[model samples]
Target chain A: MTETASLRRAARRYRLEFGGAMAAYALTVLGTSLWIDANPGSSARLPVALLPVIPVVLVVVAAVRFFRSQDELLRRRQVEALAFAFVGTALAVITYGFFETVGFPRLSAWWTWGTMAILWCVGTFVSSRRYG
Target chain B: MKNLLRVLRTERGWSQLDLAEQLGVSRQTVNALETERYDPSLPLAMRIARLFERPVESLFFLDEDAT
Candidate 1:
């Protein structure tokens, strides 16, 4: 198969895995929320809170698989993209830290992950365009 | 570094995808090589040269400015 075809197939599989993860995440969130509502002071809160991470791990695994399946050139592009995203996110977090010190409201930890994901997407697009 | 990848591929009447398939690489790799955006490894360069039935030196060359 052509590299593009292989990549597309890998992408399709990743998408399916991602979809499954998202579905599981949604269900876990719903279940946790309902359980929390029913038992506002339950001892199971800690475990419930961690349930969503199960699907997240699956998503991460799918990402690793996708990365492993890429050709060397594509892998290099991804490495560049990841480096860009890492540096960008670091700078953003540092800037946010400065803002926090100046009395800005502290954001959730998930915002960091969200920033990385956004920057990674941007980096991938930029890098691909640069190479293309 | 510079190479006549585009010229060679054109001479062979091969699309990037066709060349990539023969090279066991992605079309993007072929495109990157043609555009000089990325350099192939020695082994990959040799594979490309072999595919085109040319010496590696004939297929690729260093730019004077690059030195």
Candidate 2:
């Protein structure tokens, strides 16, 4: 198969894996939250609360596989984007940490990941435009 | 870096996507190469040279060399 065909196949596989993982994550989160609320004194509360992490791990694996499937140029772009996201998210979170001490609301740890994801998208867009 | 990518590509009437397909890269990567926005890695440069049947040095050079 041509590179384009191979890339398309990889992309299709990635989409499916990512979609499935995200769906599982959502369901696990919903289920676990409901279970915890219904069984506040349950002995398995900690384990049930962490159930969503399994799908999250799968999502990370899917991402790694997708990254490996990319060509060198795309890989470079991804690296650059990830670096941007890493630094941007770190700075934002650290800055917000100081604000919390001054009276800001405490944010969930998930916000850090969400911020990084948004920054990654922004970085990818900027990098794409730079190359174009 | 300066390169003869655009000239050679146009000479053969190949679109960016066509060359990208030949080079196993995205069309945007081809555009980046042609526009001198991004430099290819050594292996990729060699691949391009092999594809065009040209010496690597002949295909790409420092910008100062153009002057």
In terms of lDDT, which candidate is strongest? 2
Report the CAPRI category for model 2.
medium
lDDT of 1 by residue, B1-67 (tens): 8998999899889888988878888888898999998889899999999998999998888898445
Model 2 has an lDDT value of 0.92
lDDT of 1 at A76: 87
Clashing pairs in 2: none
Where in model 2 is the C-alpha error above 4 Å? A1-3
Candidate 1 lDDT by residue in tens digits, A1-132: 445677678889999998999999999999988888899888988898889999989989998998998878889889999999999999999999999998999999999999999999999999899888
Per-candidate RMSD, Å? 2.2, 2.0
Q: Give per-residue CA lDDT, model 2, range A1-132, as digits (tens).
A: 334766888899999999999999999999999999999889999999999999999999999999998887788888999999999999999999999999999999989989999999999998878777
Q: What's the chain B TM-score of candidate 2?
A: 0.97
Candidate 1 chain A lowest-lDDT run of ten: A1-10
DockQ scores for all the models shown?
Answer: 0.58, 0.52
- The TM-score between candidate 1 and the true structure equals 0.91
Q: All models: lDDT?
A: 0.90, 0.92
lDDT score at residue A54, model 2, on the 0-100 scale:
100
